[model samples]
Target: MNAIIDKLKMLKYVEVTASWLFANAKGRDAKTFVKSPQFASYPEPTIQITSPDCGASPATLSPEYMAGGDGRLPGLEWESVPGVKQWLLICEDVDAPLPNPICHGLYLGISKDKLSVTNSDFKPENEKSTRLNGGFYYGTNRLWIPPRPLLNHGIHRYFFDIIALSEPLDEKLAASKPTREQLAKEIDGKILGWGRWIGQCERVWK
Candidate 1:
């Protein structure tokens, strides 16, 4: 009976994998057959900032940041890319064990003069006080505190995205801590480049 159940599970996995491959293959083939010259043009790559190091994939529990040591927030750094008037920081957990990714944090209109910020730097009284969602201003320090009964979900990948805009945004908008939708409306076409860092985390304890 156990063997039969295992075989059924394996079959289901195979079916899902095959279906995904088939869909992806068809999409690639369709793209290749497109004759439009406009479709041939590829967009330029965006500049990226990372923690530990760019392109370095580490578990969120790594010692890179104090909070991340226990599946919390990670430390971050970035290279100075040319033509970056301003930057936006967005973090999402792709492996949320759900249909859609979960947002961890977001900061927009980061000044070019600012270099690196640690988990502690995100505290309410820190320099970015106004950037927090509410007037309370929960910076990296505060945001890292896992909710009660710590979520025991599967591995979650935190995507730290940085977008370099072509033009500087209005100072008023930056100070107000606008929603992502608000920023999208003002800076959609003005995005000159962007970058991202991905880190994984999981709650091992139930």
Candidate 2:
């Protein structure tokens, strides 16, 4: 009976491996996504985002910023360009196991007077304070949506994007939750500057 149990365990391992391979066979790997031309066509503004907490373009991510980690959003500082009235902040995982990349965070209605976000700004209990700062609305990414990419999927890249808009979003627009598609409608001709930072996270699932 013990020998039979061991054989079953081995078979289970093989099945898991096969499932992972099938899920990732389409070359949805991070390397290809980072280099994909679709990225090039997107608007890139001259603004910049940084963290007193992190170095510029560090390849590896700390567990504190990843899914299943402590989930403390690293504090961020950014610059604004001339003619900007507001900004949008977003974080996206380009290598999820799905038809499209997952949108982790989509924060809108950030005011021009604001230039930074702290770890506490992400706490759900602090809505009053968040709305008072860079926010007329703190859309999606209200929570720090960490990367939990499957190990077999290889390393995943999460992009933190900031876009400067020429004017404050309309009150009606601020009240509604906007998806990436909806946000694009307002941004198409109005963006003045863009800032971005990328981090890589990989899990050890097997």
Candidate 3:
């Protein structure tokens, strides 16, 4: 039994060494062959949002709720970006049924002063109710409709984009459901930095 244990330990060490060697080789190859793009040419700085000190899980929609109708999760907050005057919130599912990704939610002109928002927090009655789907702010929509691709389509990655702008966005401009293109045009060369949080939703039903 002692001999068997010793052999297992040796095997573990060998496996770790092999993995380390492979990773080193891959790094070397990438450095040798890959011509990485400069940071200046990138669209925007990507900041990843994670749970605070207690190690909280990323915001997630309940499977039961998702299957039923409601698909919004609560408990979302982030630290203010260093030099943001205005912000844009975009939630997209990268693993859609093909063609293109699914846009779950797109919220722009978020007030920088407000940090956190809870579930059903967008209600008209709520003090922080901003704007949605153009003019009518229907509070929190209980039924978040995901683009359908039949059944068992696969896992979908939801990217919640928070963009910090150099100038404050005009309220009139944000009154309508502005396209990403339009937003980009308005904030062209004015984007200071950006951040994102990712959560995943997968089809569990057959």
Candidate 4:
């Protein structure tokens, strides 16, 4: 499925022209979406998230992480915040040509004791890694879906937002395998703190 999408994306002329035709269409931004839950502003003493593979915030993600390449999830690390018992991590494309921000990955049950996850750790469900073996479960999207923006669709921003929770999510809720929207609503004021790292990507063939 992804291979087909990648192939279509390579049709640079078709993609660029189609994208230009729908230039007025809009996509949701993560910044604005976060405001709905009033999680808009980070609370005092926020954690700083960074990706060694993707470099610093607002950095450009390599093709290997996109559908055109290996589609591996970027490795990420962050400072541990006190009193966080569990964590929720969401990777989203704020510039996707959709009404809502597209969720690339949603994970729950991240133990606070774990500070980082390497790219190799995220693999096919059949081939599990230690990080995933730590009782973590994927959300609606299930696993990482590599970003594959259309050619000339302009640059797309991926926001890796991790929320520190004072307690673990409800067992029933976790079992439901909720979507990003559902998970965000469930977390609400339960947030202890949060951090975000941004990586940008674009499909351009010239």
Candidate 5:
């Protein structure tokens, strides 16, 4: 067992799979697994999420706007607000069919100077190096997976949760994109304020 763990530790991608298997084996409800309750537990909304990419809650997102399509991150703008040292952005599909919500993208430790993120910022090539010097860290969608919701899974609610932190993250925490649990744990009572936007998506064709 120790040997297996050691090997898994060296392979982050496989580690994600193994953990997912264990979490879903019992058939836990989607909400129970998809979200980290700790992260969900917050004071209240402080910053405002801007829909620089599209209109407020479109009726249905077309294919080209999704993973199966161009796979580009939509443009988004939000305020740095006050009383915060860094920011975090996460795009999640809470309505995913699986036990856990699918993470389309995650970025952390954004400098307060940013103010907004554009589609170009989501480019795959920017991956690790993007954060190496920008005082930020980007966590690629889990396993480089895109936000391709399976058709007939029902309309998915994608949330862009933007948070402001009271203090700068430690070197380790800011080094990479944090997992849901990690985000919850790290932000435990440390969040200053937050805001979010919801987008609806559904696959219409087979």
Candidate 6:
């Protein structure tokens, strides 16, 4: 599938025309992920989320973190919020040609003491890196999935959102590999604060 998309992207006319046609269909801002019954009452992002490797919001994400490269998670740091018992990070691609932003990664069960996460947190099998220790847990999604935007789809925005929770999720709930719907039910009224950092990536036709 990727090979076919790569070939199509090489056709300049096809790339230009399709990109133009889909321009308005790039979907809503990735922040829309928070527009749920669970988060509707929370104020706009108050915490500051930043990536040491990606620099800052609107930064160009390193190629190594994209799907075609190493697919490693980037190191990220965020301001700690008072009364935060747990943290959740969810990365979404807002520019995908879909009704909703596509989730690239979702992590939960982060301990209150963990204000930042290094790329190593995603590499449990590597000898140099420890398993996602200190109570971190993967949500329904895999530990992490690199963003795989369509070639010639123009620039895509990846939003890394950190949600501060007033309570830690029950261990039993985390073990169930809760889906988005399940999570919404569980965290409703528990959100204390939110923050987001964005990185951009695109596959251009040469």
Whole-model lDDT per candidate: 0.52, 0.66, 0.50, 0.75, 0.63, 0.78
Tens digit per residue, CA lDDT, model 1, 1-206: 99999997776566555444443221111211111132132243356566753246444444333243443455677766677777667665554333344446766667665555565555554455565422223222324433111134344456666666668788777666666556666776666566567676443331
For all predictions, the C-alpha RMSD in Å is 10.0, 5.7, 13.9, 4.3, 9.5, 4.1
Query: Tens digit of lDDT per residue, candidate 3, span 1-206?
Result: 99999997776566555444443221111111001222133344355454332123344444632544554443356778777776666555555433344555666666667565545544344434445322222211321443332233344455555666768777766655566556656776666566566565444332
Model 1 whole-model lDDT (C-alpha atoms): 0.52
Task: Report the number of the highest-lDDT candidate.
Answer: 6
lDDT of 3 at 3: 100
**Model with the higher lDDT, candidate 1 or 6:** 6
lDDT of 6: 0.78
lDDT of 3 at 174: 68
Task: Kindly list the per-residue Cα lDDT of model 5 for residues 1-60, writing each as its tens digit.
Answer: 999988855665554444444442322224532244544655456677767667554435
Tens-place lDDT per residue, model 4, 33-99, is 3545647556332779898888879889888888979887888999888889898888888777666
Span of ten consecutive residues with least summed lDDT in model 1: 27-36
lDDT of 5 at 5: 86
Deviation of model 3 at 53, angstroms: 14
lDDT of 2 at 98: 63
Worst 10 residues of 6 by lDDT: 125-134
